[model samples]
Target chain A: MISSDVIRGYNDTFLLSLLTKGDSYGYDLSRQIRELTDDAYIIKETTMYSAFARLKKNGYITSYPGTVTQGKKRTYYSITENGRNYLKEKRQEWRITKEVVDKLVGGDNK
Target chain B: MNTIREYIEQMFKGVPVTEETVQLKADILGNLEDKYTALKESGASEHEAIVTVIAEFGDIDELLEEFGVSRVNEQVTKNYETMSESDLRQYIQAKGKMGWNIGLGVLACLTGVAGLLLFLAFQSVLSGALYIGLLFLVGFSVIGIGLFIIEGMKAGELERFSSPYIILPGDKEQFISEQKDYKRSFIFSIVAGVSLCIMSITPILVGALTAVLPILVGVAFSLLLIGVGIIFFTYSGNIWSAYESIKHNGKYVEVIEKETVKHKRNKKVDYVIDEIYWPIIVVIYFVFSFTQGTWAWSWIIFILAGALESTIKSLAGSWDKD
Candidate 1:
């Protein structure tokens, strides 16, 4: 399992990446994140909520009150244009970060 | 499902109910429901699903802080400080009753005084009438003492009357309006009390124009003070009741539960001591007065007993500290 602290900075990236496909509510996004990680990571409910609040506040995502299903209403979040750009930048940042850390750790292992 | 909902409500108790907060609560509950359903589908028992779902829901404070809302619990702690709900209610009710009992007792004593003054004023009129008046004075004094004792007992009984815990339901706007009304009433009561105190002394100043009128004016002033004091006392009581009803909102469940446990532990011993203390002091006063025929000095026994009772209480408190 990936430690949450190791992935904390990328939580917005994960959420925004999920919303890029289409709009999704909290539970659906959480489930998708867990599945994408092959059940090795579970984003805490609070973590997911904080990420959503931060993403929406920064204009990276927009939320709307979705239609109630079976008497339960959900807040659906969709990525913004700025969110797409941020996700692309985050992907590039991740590539550089992983490359540097992998080299240092791989050299130590060898 | 009902249990889950109740759990969610309890978790959100101290959070301010804004539009964003309302949405957050609904979203969390919806997510929990999904989790619970999934667990149950995977052949988890109902109890297991509830336990697992709750354990996974994470801390409520984090969510509240993330949303930038001030916690109601923290605000209650700051405002009320160390006063538990039961302690606060009991303190206020006891204060009100004490005010009432003292006011009525003073009035009763004044009735005896008035009767005695009547007897003295008409002593030369007829001996029979004066003796009858003296008898009435004694009767009134006894009745005054009796009423004091009875009222004290009734107040003790009221201490055991447990008030129900209620949450104030309105939003921030409603709370502000209610608070405004409370402050206005509070200021009005203080102003009335101060004005009445000043007015009460006016009779004495007016009596300066005449000789014998001063005594009559003084007596009237005392009665007026008692009347106004009682009015202010009860009005303050109402104000405190309103404050308590609002101040302890969202936190009453925990406060009341703690009070019940503490009350149950201390009640029996405290009740016995409280029930007998005043009666014993009264009995000592009567016994000393009747046996020694020292009415002048026997009143000192009450003052001494009051001092002794307080000293004993402080000693016990210090011992507990040790």
Candidate 2:
């Protein structure tokens, strides 16, 4: 199971990676993260919005206004090429981290 | 499923859900909904599944921190650190307004003096210049008092009390105490000195020395009095923030323990007290001295009135509990 800290540290990467596939809004993005993690990781709306702001600020994502169901105009965010590259780098970092952690923790489990 | 939906709805409920926040909220909700559907399929009750999903979302503040959005109240946070804390606090207490009003008072004084001198130059046996001097003094006095009233109103207004986070920015209790003492001492010192110069100078001179002594004494007195006024007021500026903090209940002024350099977020600091505080006194003094009265006593009285005014003001300022 992923710790809360781990999810927080990686929220930006996960959101950007998800958007790189297609544009999405807040609720949908949080739902997607749960699906991908098999419910192991979930991002709150507040967390997701904050990550979106950061990603947008860093030029990794762009947001535009669009209408969703219930006549609500929602902001939709899409990943930029820069965001894709950022996700790639973060993914590599996560891989290295997982490898190091597994070696350390699984050593005794086995 | 129920718990997740409830949490999702709650999160979005009161928030503006502006375009930027909405997009992120929607994405998170979608991810949650998917999990809820899967959990329901696995035979978890709707409410249980939703609760489980909501519980996993984690702390919101940490999430916002990554985006640098957690420091949302940047203006309040920056107020203390952006300027010299002492300077900013003084600035808010309408010190600049004070300085501005003092300048006006000085101008009014000069104007009264000019009016009086003109009256003397133009006067004849038929019409004396005394009335002109009195008129000018009275006119300028009105203007000076008007400025003081306006400054007080500005200081007391609700809008001026506003800071980003809390009341006047600093240790508010200490601020109030120091301000009280400062105002008290300042007013007392000026009034006492002026009264001494006016009421006691003759007795002092008669009792002490007689040659060129009175003139020397007058020079010494002026220098000493002006010097003391400047020193006390300058020190008072340093504690002005504390005064404001105390007045504000220490809530509005956000005391920033950490330093930040962004000045745009910092509120008012380092106001010009001289502008507001000195003008009326100066106007009254110069008007009385340079206008209708040429006697040495006139100068003494002018200076004495100024001293008395300062004392009264200080007393009034200290009346507040803060």
Candidate 3:
């Protein structure tokens, strides 16, 4: 499993990407993130909610009262245009950071 | 479900109650409830599901920090403990007893007045009536004051639990429902008191008119009727207020809707009338006695005022909720 400290920087990116997939709620988004990471990661509930708060605060994501299922009222989140743009920038940032770190440590691994 | 709800409530406890914080709690509760339900459906036991859901909730401090709610603001939370179910029940019972004692004390004092009046009212019919009246006054007043002292001691014991606790998280629904259950009985007690107070005057007035009893005898019994009615009503009112005070405790108020908090606080102020109602009733008693020359009829107004006030508190608190 990926350590929370290692993945902390990209929490917003993963959430925004899921929002871009479709309007989704916190629990579902967290589940999707875990499955998509193939069990290597599971977003903390606080981390997910905090990211949602930050994204909504920054206008990167918008939320609304969504459907109730099994007696629970869910707040669904969808990515805004600004959120997609931010997600794109994060993707680029991750690629370059991955490249640099890999090059720096790649030789030691071999 | 309650575990999930309490996890969310505790996570946000000690923080200020604001729209943002409330929404934050709602959001967390919604997500956690969904997750817990899904986990349960997947063959996980309740304990296992709750553990998983809470584990994923991560550190409460993290969310608190994210929202910039620092440890310094936690003093309010530290001041209150979550009141358990048994504790609430016990406190309510104690409050009930205290209320009954206080009401009974008042009744005793009133009955003493009636006992004293009985001798004076029938002095023509009996010898040494005035002296017996004085004795009656001293004796019943002693009993009434004794009851007051005992009830006061009970209240002193209760003072420790009064302001320092709030409702336990999951108990909120049960609290509201129990309050609702008490509603019917409370109204019944109020009405019963009213009936008793009315009975205090009616029988003697009718008996005197029929020459079955002296008109003066009615005065003594009127006070007795009023006293018993006050006790009955006061008992239920006290229990109802205990539930109310518990509901409005600062910890319980944290997660309540913003309007509910407002209504509850308003109810607190609204109840200051409890202190002044007797004075108002006394004033009304005098006005009725002087204006209409009917002391017998006017005194029952105390019971009427009591019932009216309790009904208002009961209805207005709920009215604001709606």
Candidate 4:
């Protein structure tokens, strides 16, 4: 389980990383996150879209008209080079943070 | 499962939940259907399988929060969109500047009125310049009205309810920050007003000694400028009072994902000439004109008719639906 404050920042970064691979719709993205977390995490559609809004505003990613198999066209977002760089930076930062916290929490066990 | 769906819908009941949220719900249901399919393959009864899936799904509130939606689903009453952060800053700056202009203009109007009265009292010495002095009075009135009207028009264009720059929308902390900035500027204005009042003492006393009563004369002239400033600042009904007042008026326009604001009160452009201002201007013109015993009724009748026109306009606007 993740603390709510930390979770939001993580979710934003994770979404950016996923988009760096290719375009995906909201539902598919949420399911991918679930599978990645081994069912430990589930993101709501609202959070995903809100992050999408923030990312779009910051110029990290851009959206375009794309059609899915089902209904009307959906606004599919692709990661710009800027988004890819941001994801790389965030990944390094999160790794360092997780490593430091894990040491402190596991000091006695170690 | 139906109970869970009902619960989720009930939770989102009054919020302006966008179409995206509805589609998201359908996705969640699809996931639930998948879970139900897996449970049925294990040979459990259909109702029990549904219950198991519902139990596994946990709370939707946490899911909603993950998407940055407000959990405490109160209807957002003031939906003022279009007033972006930069626009808001511009509005505040414009209002402060308008206040300064009104204050200074009022001081000028007072000087003009006092100069006319004093010049008239010593009419024997400056008889040649009296017409020039009358010209100043008319000129001041025209300038005052012109500035007031322009400011009112600016105020009208300001977006009423939504502020775009505030990233974490509806945060009380941001609200407090805005209020503090407003209060600080408002106090600064009051201090400036005191200094202005002091500046008017010399001309006011000099005019009274020459014959026109000082306090009554001073107050009348002062209010004209103040009224003009208020109109200038509150011109578009975009001031702090406007924000509060419009809430009492309810959003006048329907809006969607992109924010839009509706004017609650009358949108009539009343030129910022209040009752107090007209009476004062008329009396000053009347005093100086009657002192000269020229045809003064024209000024008086004109002021009276203008006042009647504004009053009728205001009353007629009330006929709009509640």
Candidate 5:
């Protein structure tokens, strides 16, 4: 399992990327993230919620009450124009970050 | 699933209610339910699924802190640890005094009923001077109630200064034992109260036995009930002091302080209204009783006053909510 600390900074990027596709509620977003990562990283409920809060606060995403299921109403989040821009920037930043880390640690150990 | 929902609710019990917080709670619960369902479908046992889901959800405090919601338990635990021994002793003393004052107030209220009963039994035979003496007893009881209320209020003021001592999570066994003791005391108090009420009426049932015997027995029963009820009431009050001291701590203090600040203006209005309301109601009751001699129906005003007080309280509460 991937430690949260290693991927903390990019949690919002992952969430916003999913929202970029379509409006999704909490559980659906979490499920998609799990599927995408092949269960290597199961984002904690807390981390997921904190990401949503941060994204919404930064106007990177907007939320609305979705269709009620099993007597529970879900808050559906959709990415905004600002969110798309933010995600593009994060992707570029991650590319650079990964390249540097790979250069430092990817070579075979003695 | 219901257990999961209840557990989540318990975790957020002291969290401030706001639109964002409500949404956060709903979102968390939804995700937990999904995780639990997925685990169950993956051939996990019910227990395993629940345990896995909960374990993976992580600490609630971290989530609350992310939203800038202060952790009530952390504050409470800190307060408990830092409380000085002298302060704790002072708090315990104040709490004991408050309990005694409240107990006295209840006893004084009960004495008013005894005074009324005495007047009923002796009104036919007693001289006008003695009748007035009975009225004096009733008057004194009411004054006693008022004095105890003031004393209780003073004790409460003192209690506010001393930090409350909370039972820590590590002391789970002690907490459970205290809870059990509280339950036992609560039941004992109820039994004592009910028995006192029944015994007080026994004299009326035996009134047909003899006229003089009825008055004698009635007074005796009243005295016994008073003694027994006071003992039970005091015992329960002591138990409650223990319970509240362990339970409240810093979170309780913060909530109370917040409430007082929120309702400060309303409380002042309530006080003034209460002062005016009771006197007006009393005047109306007496006027009807003396002028039309409708003592039976005039008593309805007290019931109306009770209804009016609750209506005002609810109105104030809704206003605060808005």
Candidate 6:
């Protein structure tokens, strides 16, 4: 149940990481995120949708109506070269951010 | 399916419709349909699939905020209040009752017309029947118009129908499902009404040719059937009118249900609305094939609805454990 505000900054990072693995449609991406987080975080459809628009607008991802294995027309997203660079930059930023936050909160506040 | 489509449509309402917005809408629909199909294929019931898809559809304001659209400003632009869940349910239920009022009203009017027609068609046999016919017309039309005025005030809530409040998503879902169910009923009403209208004419044609049944009685039966048909239309048709004009949604329904269960409250509030809907006039119509006092039943029901509407509303909104 991480707040959207907490993750809003990294929505692109999370999405592009997944997109770099392979092209994926909206539902499939949501499904993968749900599984990957072990259900800790489930993205709302609107949130996912907004992220897609932002990614496409920023030229970080490209979309086309791709046919899935089931033969349904799906809007699929794949990470662009620019998207890959952005994800890498985010990863580096997160490494330092996580270490700094962890130290400030202590080893295990709980 | 209409529920889902309508829900999405309601969200996109008020925003300027555009090519990009249309594509976004299509993409959103595409995702939802895909998820729904997968859920169904994985053995979710139709009801379960729909609920899951809608529950997960998320908030429109979340989308609006991301896009830097000011929803608050939009509300202020119009004198709109956030419509509470109870307000919506009351509106819907009132709207449902209004349907019955109008349907019954139409029935009364038509029966009155039928009574007069019966006299006209069989004036040769029955002496002074035209007076009775005139009485029927005057009596029933007065009752019909009375019902219209009563309904005008009740559904005058229609002024608040689209205004006064924002629909939370949960309440919105409740309404969407209710509207979906009512929409199916509406289709049934259309078929039944049209069939009834057709059948109303047949008795006259058959009776005039065969002289088997009295033409007056046949005419009465014919008009009564048409009246019933119209009842179906007004009852279901009101829902569509509300659906088109409303741009609201809800999550308050879920919260209310939770509170109801948590309190261990009396959840069963079964309304015996036949007292309010199928009142004495209809009974009289049934008793004598065409009674002198048709106004007694339709307005009896109409007045009854007006009287008990408060009780129905109170129970729906504020009934506690006691």
Q: Compute fnat per model.
A: 0.72, 0.51, 0.67, 0.05, 0.72, 0.67
**Residue B182, candidate 4: C-alpha displacement in angstroms:** 4.0
Backbone clashes in each candidate structure, one number apiece? 0, 63, 0, 7, 0, 17
Q: How big is the positional error of residue B45 in model 4, measured in Å on the Cα after superposition?
A: 28
lDDT of 5 at B134: 65
> Residue B220, candidate 5: how far off, in angstroms?
77
Best by lDDT: 3
List where candidate 6 sits over 4 angstroms from the true fold.
Answer: A1-110, B1-78, B120-126, B163-165, B214-217, B247-322
- TM-scores, in order shown? 0.43, 0.40, 0.50, 0.42, 0.45, 0.41
Return the TM-score for candidate 2, rounded to 2 decimals: 0.40
Interface DockQ of each model: 0.51, 0.27, 0.42, 0.07, 0.46, 0.39
lDDT for residue A29 in candidate 3, whole number 0-100: 88
On residues A1-110, what C-alpha lDDT tens digit does candidate 1 reach at each position? 77888888888899999898999999998889888889888888888898888888789999998999878889999999999999999999999999899998768766
lDDT of 6: 0.70
Tell me candidate 4's TM-score on chain B: 0.42
Candidate 3's docking class is acceptable
DockQ score for model 1, please? 0.51
TM-score of 1: 0.43
Per-residue lDDT over A18-52 for candidate 2, one digit per residue giving the tens place of the 0 to 100 score: 88778987767777887888977666655666677
lDDT of 1 by residue, B1-322 (tens): 7788999999887765446777898899999899899889999999999997787677777776666665665444333323333444454566566655655665566566556655555566668766776687688678768867876676666442333332223332354465577676677775775565556555555655567565444544544564555456455645455454445332342354455454443444445556888789879877986698543345456557767876775666556447
Task: Give the residue spans of candidate 2 off by over 4 A.
Answer: A1-8, A12-32, A35-40, A45-92, A98-110, B1-95, B102-106, B121-134, B158-322
Query: Model 3, range B1-322, lDDT digits (tens) per residue?
Result: 8877876776676765544556778878877887888888989999999998888888777776666444333654454454566667788899998889989898889888888887887898799999999899989899999998988777887764555354544465677789999999999998898788778878577657777666656767777888898898779989998888777652453543333446546647465765676677778787878799676667657657867977877776677668
Query: Candidate 4 clashing pairs?
Result: A46-B67, A47-B67, B80-B161, B80-B162, B81-B162, B155-B236, B156-B236
